[model samples]
Target chain A: MEKELKKIEKVISNLELNSQAQIQELLKNFLKTHLKKSKIDNFIGDYPTFIEPVYLNVNVKIGDDVLLGPNVYIGKNTEIKNYVEISNSIIFDNALIGENVKLNNCIIGKNTLLNCENINIDNCVLVGNVKTKEDVYRIMYKFK
Target chain B: MSEKRKQEIQRIKELESINLARDEIRDLVIDTKKEVEKDNDLLAAQINDELNKRGIKSIDIVGAIGAGKTAILEKITEKLSKKYRILVICGDITTRVDADRIEKHNAETVQINTGRECALNAYHINQVIKNKDLFDFDLIFVENVGNLICPSDFKLGTDKRITVVSITEGEWVIEKHPMLFKMSDIAVINKIDLLERLGTNIDKMIKDACGFNPDIKVITTSAKTGENIDTLIEALEL
Candidate 1:
């Protein structure tokens, strides 16, 4: 029985040392290597917010505080500002994210993000492609 | 060397081979997991938000030229626009003619004549939504520039996509313009009242619609006479 245990240990040790699979090897190395917690802050700014503490993952970076939905997917290296609310979509990084916006199936810009509120995206990609001097607004008008 | 020793050595070598392969597979799974994690996280966030505030949803309506989309929009908005918060946008190469007609329905409308159609993306749709305050509206409707080609390649960021087809065009529409039907999430047979006069077979049309999306919901309607328009409304409302 002792010999069998030794054999099993040997198999595990062998697996630990192998690196044939690229991602596995990367993950293995990540596991085996030392890791330091990133200093970058990713959090919802607290102050008169509807709900506190937008659910976050290890990879995302948030500003002071942002209102977030349950399925908001923040990609690696994303930097979200305070007072931003995102729901149901992938938000990529350094994204100058705006406040009070809802998104879905939308890929924000590599460098493009909006600061305007009351925006919603569906199955689309917005690069903040062009710089504008005017702030976009959606207002209600009374029929005369 | 003894046979036993030789056999043990061979077993070790076999184990080493397995270890190599296992490591490789493990790495692949880890990479895949990152993507899946992102997807899962996004889905999780959406669910959390949707549950909390009821939900903010948008719908996209697409069709080919002369599909009578504007006519149908007239019927839809007249009956249900006020009941549901509705935001409307019209697309044409260089004109807001359709938007003018649709605007008569009393929905806040945006006329997006980009001159070029290639730029239609999630980003563009997002802009329109924001500009139109579409999210604030109960139902946001986007009327594509009457072309099935360029629009299909880009996602307009709507929750559901309904493709419109008219019977006056012909029964061969499904067989010829399969891509248009194939790309949309739902297939709508517009101008169905013209079936008998135009020799358009409703069953064959249904079959053709199914060829692209077997589960596709088809409604035969005539805005002219208000036939089966109720079913169309039910499909959209549901």
Candidate 2:
């Protein structure tokens, strides 16, 4: 079992830089090759939420009024405030998102505070602890 | 040796090679910069002599990203384009957005895409000047890449170095990046209009700049409202 786990670790490390589609295909292949049919069926039945579009890898606190779009990754201990809409974005751990904020196609850095109201952010990689209400356009230029 | 021992030896060798490669790259970058600085010193002297002979003026504007460097340039160009034949060289890692904006103000503009370079070296300025007749223009402005650190290290052969810091960048920015202020002839605290909204202490920022460099001329401006722009022009002797 230890040897088999080591083999899986090797595959995962090798596929670290690969595209999402490629990684998913490789993971599926690995699961098919390693797991028994009955075990796979039982695992799928027990954790039926695995097939869902929204994948919550860790414990998150989301408000009831918040709306999340497809392919959202909310990290552990993040507070999604009321009326916030997030889509195609990865919100890192320990972030406090404010009310009525709209984020799309962005990577919210760890320990960030998106406390701006009615702000629309897109294609932005906000650094940790970025406190701003102004329009932050194409912030990737700063990183580069 | 056992299989595990052999694998450990291979891993150590790989790590050593990676460290050696990193050291070599660091050395190469340092040497290249030293050589470039030497070349730049000579080129800058030549550019200065030529500009002095033609009685023309030049200014290099440096600041962090979103610190209102481009906006300040646009405001300055709009005010002086009628009196002086102006030329602006906009430098950035990518995109000609600033160049397009400056061209709209009736200034002859050129865009320098530096690829991965953080600052515009004197070689870039020399090349741009060589292609154009410097005698045709009275004032030249070079809007450097939006970097507070790297741009301070490089001199792009300008008469005045203006560093623009906006209120949006936080108050501690002036104290944090004192080298930029030390090198700059004029330090502009831009986006003063946002002061009430951001609650940034403008007097403290100016005092910090002055404290770092007593000779550095400081101006508080709002490029959006055109506030204290004439004061900036006066400071530049334009």
Among these predictions, the greatest DockQ belongs to 1
Q: For candidate 1, lDDT tens digit of each residue in B1-238?
A: 9999999999999999999999989978989877755654455345334423545555677777898888888788888776877777666554456767877887766655443343234534544443232246666677877876666655565666788878887777766777667756667788867776787776887898888777678888787787877788888754
Q: Candidate 2, residues B1-238: lDDT per residue as tens digits?
A: 9999999999999999999999979978999989888888888878877777788899999999988989988998999999999989888775568988998998987666554578877766765676466878999999999999998777777899999999899889999999999989999999999888999988889899999999999999999999999999999976
Q: How much is B43 displaced in model 1, in angstroms?
A: 14
lDDT of each: 0.56, 0.71
Instruction: Name the runs in model 2 displaced over 4 angstroms.
Output: A1-144, B1-9, B17-32
Distance (Å) between predicted and true CA of B87, model 1? 0.2
The weakest ten consecutive residues by lDDT in model 2 chain B span B123-132
Chain A vs. native, model 2, TM-score: 0.56
